[model samples]
Target: MKIALIAHDKKKEELLDFVSKHKDVFSQHELFATGTTGLRVNERTELPIHRFKSGPLGGDQEIGARIANQELDAVFFFRDPLTAQPHEPDVSALIRLGDVYRIPMATNIGMAQILIHAIRRNEF
Candidate 1:
């Protein structure tokens, strides 16, 4: 399974922790992430991840393209809904693409936990 891991600035740590908690499952699949998130996740978990531009700099679009191309199986996007975002449209577009493609998407940690378990069991 190819999964994209994404998070807003305020949610990066939470996403990182979630990924770490599920490293065994995640390590079995291909991982993709935006620039800083990828870098930090790699540094902490040492998981090989394909990195793209930062979200504000087009990473969301890059991942959205992957979704459109069927290059991604699932998405774990830990969005910070409370805070205003500069790239709101891009974020919305990414989520919309996920929905359009019927790809599994987890926008919060609780949902992410379910997705991670499904991944572990090869449910997706």
Candidate 2:
């Protein structure tokens, strides 16, 4: 499976923690992430990751391309709804592409954990 991870500035630590706790499960698959989030996650776990540009700088589009190409299996996008983003369209497109591609996507922590757990349990 190929998993793409993205986190808003405020959720980076939480995302990193989640990845660290589930390193074993994540290690079995390929990982992709936006620049700073990937760097933060790498600091906490050994999961191999392909890093893209920062979300505001084209990372969302990079990941969106993979989703459109049917190259991604799942996505965890930890967006901060309370804060407005400069790249709203890119973010929206990524979310929309995930839906069009039928790939599982989690925009918050609860859903992210649920999806990861389901994948680990072979319930997908």
Candidate 3:
């Protein structure tokens, strides 16, 4: 399965920690992520991830395109709802595309845990 990992600035650490905790599970699949988030995760966990542009710089749209093409199996986006994003529309579009494609997505740690477990069980 192809999975994407994304997170807002304030939530990057949380996302990183979650990824670290699930590294064993995640290592079995192909990974993709936005620029800074990808860099940080790779730096810490040494996971080989395909990196896209920064979210504000078109990463979300790139991932959305993949969703439209049915290339991605799941998305783990740790959005910071309390903060204002400069490219809010792109984020919304990505979420909408995920829904349209019926892709599994987790915007928080709890949901992410479920998705990871599902993956572990070969449910996808």
**RMSD in order of candidates:** 0.6, 0.8, 0.5
| Candidate 3 lDDT over residue span 29-80, tens digit each | 9999999999999999999999999999999999999999999999999999
By the TM-score metric, which is better: model 2 or model 3? 3
19-108, model 2: which lDDT tens digit per residue? 888889999989999999998887778667999999999999999999999999999999999999999999999999998889999999
Candidate 3: where are CA atoms >4 Å away?
Answer: none
lDDT values for all models: 0.95, 0.92, 0.96
The TM-score that candidate 2 achieves is 0.97
For every model in order, what is the number of clashing pairs?
Answer: 0, 0, 0
- How much is 100 displaced in model 2, in angstroms? 0.9
- Candidate 3's displacement at residue 33, Å, is 0.4
Better of 1 and 2 by TM-score: 1
At residue 48, what lDDT does model 2 achieve? 72
Error of 2 at 17 (Å): 0.8
lDDT of 3 at 68: 96
Off by over 4 Å in 2: none
In the range 1-124, model 1's lDDT, one tens digit per residue, is 8999999999999999998999999899899999999999999999999999999999999999999999999999999999999999999999999999999999999999888888888787
Point out the worst 10-residue segment of candidate 2 by lDDT.
39-48
Model 1 alpha-carbon drift over 4 Å, by segment: none
